[model samples]
Target: MKLREIAHSRTGDKGNISNISLIAYDMNDYEKLKQAVTAEKVKAYFSDIVKGDVVRYELPNIGALNFVMYSALGGGVTRTLAHDMHGKGLSAALMNMDI
Candidate 1:
């Protein structure tokens, strides 16, 4: 099943960094999300775009996972000529991943 089936995501950006938070729709599914969504997988998923590192922070208490991707904004909002400079679409792209 796709990760979006069980969770939703929110994204934010700062300079060249992008932060995405995936929150489980049902708390019970948090564990499954944890096991399936790793820093390595996320980094690989966005390999072409994220030029730096992907760090995963587990928010078990909130039934969520936060991914901090470095160098993901093509040099921040002002510098990047990309359409999605803020990388908001990245959250949607990640949601398409199979869990």
Candidate 2:
């Protein structure tokens, strides 16, 4: 099962840092996401692009997981020559993860 089936993601970027928020559509699926999704997994999944550490913050009250990835934007939007400088596609890529 793909993560997208149960949740959706939103991404934000600042400097070389990228933050992805995974929010479950149904509250019941939150636990399942928590069990399967981890900072390590996310870090590994985006290893090619992310150059630093991945940190996950659980927001049980909102049934969401927030991942902070460092050194992920090449060198931030202002400096990176990549087409998707904002790293928004990363959220969609993360949705492809198996749950």
Candidate 3:
């Protein structure tokens, strides 16, 4: 199953970094998410776009996982010629990950 089936995501950006938060639809699935989604996996998944380190922060109390992707915004929104400068579509792209 895709991650989207069990969780939803929100995206934010600052300079060349992208912050993606994945929240489980049900608290019971939080464990599954933690086990399946890792910083290494996310870095590999977005290898084409993410040029720096990927860090994962667990939010067990909120049933969510936050990923901080460095050098992901093509040198920030103002300078990037990329269509999705704000990296909004990144959340949607992440949702497609297989769980």
TM for every model, in the order presented, reads 0.96, 0.95, 0.96
On the 0 to 100 scale, the lDDT of residue 26 in model 3 is: 99
lDDT of 3 by residue, 5-64 (tens): 999998999999999999999999999999999999999999999999999999999999
Question: Considering summed lDDT, which 10 consecutive residues are worst modelled in model 2?
Answer: 81-90
In model 2, the runs with Cα more than 4 Å from the true position are: none
- Cα displacement (angstroms), candidate 1, residue 24, comes to 0.3
lDDT of 1 by residue, 30-52 (tens): 99999999999999999989999
Q: Name the candidate, 1 or 2, with the larger TM-score value.
A: 1
Candidate 1, residue 17: how far the Cα is off, in Å: 0.3
Shift in Å, residue 78, candidate 1: 1.1
Ranking by lDDT: 3, 1, 2
List, in order, the clash count of every candidate structure: 0, 0, 0
Q: How well is each residue in 52-97 modelled by candidate 2, as lDDT tens digits?
A: 9999999999899999999999899799888785758889899999
